[model samples]
Target chain A: MRNSFKKVYLLISVLMVVMLAACSEDETNATSEKSGGPVSAKIGVISYMTGPGAAYGEAITNGFNLALDEINEKGDVKIELIIEDSAGKQDQALTVAQKLMSSDDIVALLGPTLSTEMNVVGPEADINGIPIMGTSTTAAGIPQIGEYVFRNSIPESLAIPAALEKAVNKYGAKKVAILYGNDDLFTQSGFDTMKAEAENMGLEILTIETFQKGQSDYNAQLTKIKDLQPDLILASALYNEGAVIMDQARKMGIDLPFVGGNGFNSPQVIEIAGEASEGLIVATPWFGEKDDPKVQDFVKKYETEYGHKPDQFAAQAYDALYIMAEGLKNAGVADRDALRDALAEIKDLDGILGKFSFDEDGDVIMEPTVLIIKDGAFQQFE
Target chain B: MLGDIINPYHLQIISFILINIILGISIYITLSSGQLSLGNAGFMGIGAYTSALLTINFDLPIFLGIILGAVVAGVFGILIGIPALRLSGVYLAIATLGFGEVIRVIFVNWESITQGSIGLSGIPHLGRELFKTFKLTGFDPDMLGLKNNQFIYLLVVLILLLVNILLVWFFIRQNKSRVGRAFAAIKMDEKAAESMGINITYYKVLSFTQGAILAGFAGALYAHVMAYISPADFAYHRAIDILIFSIFGGSELIWGAIFGATFMTILPEALRFISDYRYMIYGVILIAMMAFRPQGIIDVSLLKWFKKKLKLKRGGSLGIGTKKYN
Candidate 1:
């Protein structure tokens, strides 16, 4: 047997040695802070850069990169980003948030991609008084973490109601079947919003079914919905499952207008569901076909830069950075407390997402464009 | 006596290591008896949610919440252990794995209480609020330096250290006692151990409960430190990770858990220098370590080497004695 007391002492000594060895390296880190910008901030980004959610993270990064170029060229805010991949895990997100919070120079943080991550990272950043904004975290109750927490992406609580109302108005439907992936926070929150809204609008509930994500067989749930003969289907699911659910419903010879929440705001639904996507409807704060010159300019610049059309994820992230720049410029200092105040006070900010403002809860206040899938492409729902 | 000026980044990492060490030792308790129970992660979940909810809903003291959390998990350990008495080897592993899944499903489906998949966030920052900011005030750490988070992290580390010391004493003492010998006998041959009047059922259930209690505490500590948790954190992979900690560290001794957890936790941070390739490299390193030292980092040969080098009247639990090695 080993000596317990002496081993404990040895453990402490070794840890102390590690600390001393670490301290000797001089914790002075040279930042990428450029000279001569009235608005200077170092922002940290935690994203799912290499996971299944990498598309969202990559788009956000691309958007930020594009926005940074424009802002730096204008010579107003000089921002440096220390981006870390969270790999879609909350623990990793928390770790990176702590890492970012430790540094005195990083004035702001952004984009943990998903609402679940923001649920973890948001509070930590808030306690530390760092302003953290989510570009694509659209689930409900994110900003409730603290005043420092903000999300520019429209939450499902708002987006779902709008889509459902539009679908009701168009289809003149009185009864609807709601389907959602039960295992995800994102989908659950969306489903909650849909249920509340459907009840509020006095639509009769036909059936509600829950399915697990990554499980392609939705026959069990769809058959139940099919039997109800509901006028429409309200779905809250990621693209992969959403597409299959739609495709399966169509194959089962039950074609009904499908109203989807924020998760359906992607081209993958169309790519996967094909003809079933024709009547698919979703509400979003952004669309590429807006007739505004500014929108065209953004889309053109984005396409040229990345060789792909910038989707809502890229657009929201693009607008989020611009919004941060505005907040920094208005704050007139790099202080986080001052930045939070300035961000809170922001109103009538214009970007690719159009006129945006922060509500009292730091959630985005903006009008969303309701869109419908027509001929395998997103078109304005008239 | 170097001045204690450390960044929150490093402090956070060290905190994780300490928390993981608690978890490692937790599983080590179960493994010490040669029982490979995988339900520890589920027990951890039970503890984390219980503590988090108690503190969040009832405004209980953080300590009370944590203790209550652990106690609730221990209760569950008793429940699971009763059923586990009939199974062994892979059957026990599968049963425990199923139990873990059952716990996760409960957390997910019980949305009103568990918050579903979105998880519970903004749980009180325990250490931060618990302790007053201490200063090496005369020192020149002007991070408003080390005045706040550093003290918080230090206290959390100290808590983990205290837990560690307590476990070391208990485990070291237990290892030499009649109960420890009974465990060894049971592990070697259950029939023979039972024939020797060892009371196999009692000891087996007792080990499971002890594992649950430690895991529950680890869970409480993790929830408070990170201030966030979800069903996802305590999934099947987590159960596997808890098992890997003891096995990789060398299940032959308790130090194996300590050293194994420390090395594994730090390995990821150390590999951060390699960026994205780090996880791949980490996998390779683990594979290499296993290939070379399947018995673990603290095998019989290493202990023998330590014995020869220390040259003491008798090497105790810590492997450190009053004698000078050099």
Candidate 2:
């Protein structure tokens, strides 16, 4: 029985090899045949727009879609967006990146958003001379992705300093406890950076606690930190863990100023943590309700269309798409080199997140926001 | 029908299937010995990262890098197996899971060596002995080289076929040898086998070690194919998914492992058309498959009986055989 199945498996493998080679041959033939006229502009998106990171993926797609809609509506540059899901799986991200690179239409790529996915997919983009702009992934050393790789999202290294500065200066918090999710790349990097920065800022790190991602109870970790009696708690975690940590800390009767990085900037954190997140402070690059007219218009449009206020994920994604489209428009041609030039030339374009600009390394040097959660609503700092 | 056969997407699908077939058979080696493994992904990751790193960072030949990657992954598997020998069942599962996680974490954290989760990029596209072919042809292979993924997929399929034939041949030989009986005896009842001088611990350790080696091969190929590796590629969830594939396909059936691998790999892609509903369907299908055909789709007599009832001739030259282990 095993033998026959093995035989079939072998047969299938053989058949697949022949078929795949044939397909590649066909694609080569087709591409070779279409050598003249205006080159079709290809915009590829490698996103986690499905699976465990579905919400974040959808938010990114929304950003990409918003940009495409505006670009296509104007009809200045002919562009085609070919999207493939990374599924938050690193291997799939690589596969999708390769598949996209194989297509001549793909001049540039947007992202495979998660830090891990970006890490895997970035190589292909660099090898193939495609520029990739990730919407949101704040892990340290993102600049190392490649010369062609660029991310507009503020790194955790930049984002954490703002929250740490607030905790040290505003709250007069001499002693701070560090809590973070271990499994998440962003959270881990943020926490580690904060730990170092906090120590460097002459603040005592009374307790450092870690919890795995997808964990519900932080009582053990929280209990250890609460016992340390730190003046403030700095948590580097996403909405679910953030909410749980806050809720659990409050329930445990530990009243101290709570601070977090970009992971803390989510409505779901407030919704889940409820009253516990009321006085929480977070450092973010962009807020849904900004003073800028452009940002306000976006918030208004997003709220009306989605029937809810957009989170930081959606806001950043929206801005990323706009910036990408602007690059395409500026390039005035479908050529990758030209599109890269267009991206390089982008300066002072008002995006939902603020002005969009790429440095030599393709990273946007954007200002960070320090927001406070006042009664369930995010109010900008004075 | 011809158009369908000639479609580019179909070819892509076929390529994917081939890749999965190699991965499936590689996974089957461990499963057939009644062991559960999650380290295949880790092995694949090692292969991918090592090959990519070698080609990109060191300017090594792609084919040489691929072989080195396989060897490296195999060595890693053996190393993991040595420590993992102390565990069994869920304990063993957790150990292997940790093993996979450690590989990913190392990949993510070791920035100096691995570019620290940004992924080692710009892997030269060629695999196995193909680099030599490229050198011989002097065809400016870098510009017109095979896509790394496609090459890896082909290599994986070819290796899988060779491995499957070898495994079948080995097992068939073993079926007539004392070693096969000892393994069978151990599988049936460990204490009894040990009492009968079968050296259960040795065999169990050997089983896991052998499984790990195959897993490493798969991992190496996968890494080369993808030309990238990150923590997310070989998470705890990945290990669980592989175990589920083995269990769902049937623990005793060799081909079941291959079938399970293909089904699991391609099922998600197929459901991708449904978007949100795809995961839901996948869950439902898994549950249904578990509830109804818990032994898997490869029950020999049942297949023959069903075929007879349907009055259909068994197509192809492949003959059905009885299960000696059972």
Candidate 3:
């Protein structure tokens, strides 16, 4: 019994020591802000550094870190960033947000990757009075969660109409079959926007079929669409499922031109779909091929550092960090409320995404550029 | 010194641990009767949504909302248990698992009610609101300039303590009662239990329903504490987590469930330093534990040793403190 008690005590002590070590590690990181700095802003970044959304998370992290490096090197204002991984889970996102709010003295929070997660954590940030800037959350009603919640990414409601109009006018699309993943907030909202836009554009509506996210088999949906013989298929799916759906539809001999939502704006979609991805059109806030020097510089620096072209997620994240920095400079005080007000007041802040400004609801107001995949590369659609 | 040692972050983690302990114990109630259920999370979801809607839409008091939520979930539990408890072993597990999926689908598709996948937010903080309702200005930590989370942590710990006491009492009382023997008989041999005039079906369903009620109670508290909950929060993943907690702690004793839930909840947060590799390490630890100590981290031998150390009397009750059964 005495021996067992000794073992238990030893085990507890080891655990306590490990926990203390972890706490101390965070403390060191927290205090590592450049000393002798007159003005320093501590920002917390919540990204999906692991899980299904890790790819986007990594891009956001890389973008933010790159911006951090450039800002610190410039030496105008020192900003300390503490990055936490939510792993694309709402509970983890909330936990990290709470940790950042209660423990760390953060002026702002950034990225969370998914709108679903943002919806969960956004209100908490609002209650805590911390400004949470979502870089990639584009679903509806996100900014409506709280005044403190903000997103630099353009919403599907604003971007999808332009793309639908382009599809109708440029391609003479009349009959379109709509396919969307009903489970995801992003894709479902995308489908809603597309459906609304299609109705407004006076396009013939074919049968609308829904599938769950992560479902690979689309033969049943495609077969049904094939019978309808629509001119185009409107797909609202992430790159992984979008690639499969396009490939499957083509293989099934349903060679209709596809118009996709924001989720289809990825190199992975083209790489996965291969020849099938040709002529697939999407509307996005950021197009890497833009001749604007700011866009080119960001793409060049990102490509040089990450060994690949920065996707929309990266570009938006890069701009998001810059926006936060801009807000910090504008507020001139490292206070949460001041930073939030400053972020809300942001207008015509030109960055990679072009003349970015936050509307009254904290949603980005910007014109989306239409692009189509040709010869395995995204180009401006004429 | 203790207050200085534990910061707000640690308090938050502790509150989560407490909530999970409640979940673990909820699953343990069903496992005690040898009914392997996987629908506790569905019941949790029902409780969370019900309580959240009540508080957010109707302006009901937080505690009242939580109670009503649990009661509503309990009614649904009975509804599910009547049909699901008819099956046994893996078949019963599958039925419950299917029920959990159905609940998820309903939550996702019923956009009008649940706000769909976008999820419901702006859930009022329970601790601050409860303090305000009671007019206990002095005891209200939020009013006293302490963080709202600290008050919530204290509330959660208090609830955990109350739950532990209730579980201990229920386990002790039930073990001596006729219901406990009937459950043991059904688990040991359904035919024999039937021959002994034990109503196997009734006991099984009762055990399942009771387990669901506990889970719902935990869920209601969890929703209020977190101040936000999504349907995805109570998916099959959460069911698996609850199952792991009960099994890893050894379902035979309530203390086992407590230890299992507390350890598992805190382990992930503690392993956060590893970041991406944390889940990998967690899987490894689970495998190691199962391989080495299949009976669980808290087994009969440990309980026996503990009882001896405390000089507790033997054989009065068949609850966690005693070693009458494995």
Candidate 3 docking DockQ: 0.41
lDDT of each: 0.83, 0.68, 0.82
TM-score-wise, the better of 1 and 2 is 1
Candidate 2 Cα deviation (angstroms), residue A306: 2.1
Clashes of each: 10, 8, 0
Candidate 1 docking band: acceptable
What are the runs in model 3 whose C-alpha is more than 4 Å off?
A: A1-13, A20-38, B1-7, B131-169, B312-326
Ranking by DockQ: 3, 1, 2
For candidate 1, the per-residue lDDT at A162 reads 81
Clashing pairs in 2: A42-A105, A46-A111, B43-B219, B44-B219, B47-B220, B48-B223, B48-B224, B111-B116
Root-mean-square deviation per candidate: 4.9, 6.5, 4.1
| Candidate 1 lDDT, B215-322, residue by residue in tens | 998899889987888888899988888887888888888888887787777665555444567568667867976896688777656666566655754456467665
lDDT of 3: 0.82
lDDT of 3 by residue, A67-181 (tens): 8898878766678888888888776787777778775567889968888788768877887789999999998888988899999998999877877778788768889999998
**lDDT for each residue of candidate 2 in B15-83, tens digit (9 for 90 to 100):** 454555556655555655555667777776776777777777788876677677777877776777767
Can you list each candidate's DockQ? Answer: 0.37, 0.17, 0.41
Reference-based TM-score of each model: 0.90, 0.78, 0.91
Candidate 3 residue B100 Cα shift, in angstroms, is 1.0
Clashing residue pairs, backbone N/CA/C < 3 A, model 1? A1-B316, A2-B316, A2-B317, A2-B318, A2-B319, A3-B316, A3-B317, A3-B318, A3-B319, A4-B318
lDDT of 2 by residue, A180-239 (tens): 876566787788788889989999888888787789888888888878889988898888
Ranking of all candidate structures by their lDDT, best first: 1, 3, 2
Error of 2 at B53 (Å): 10
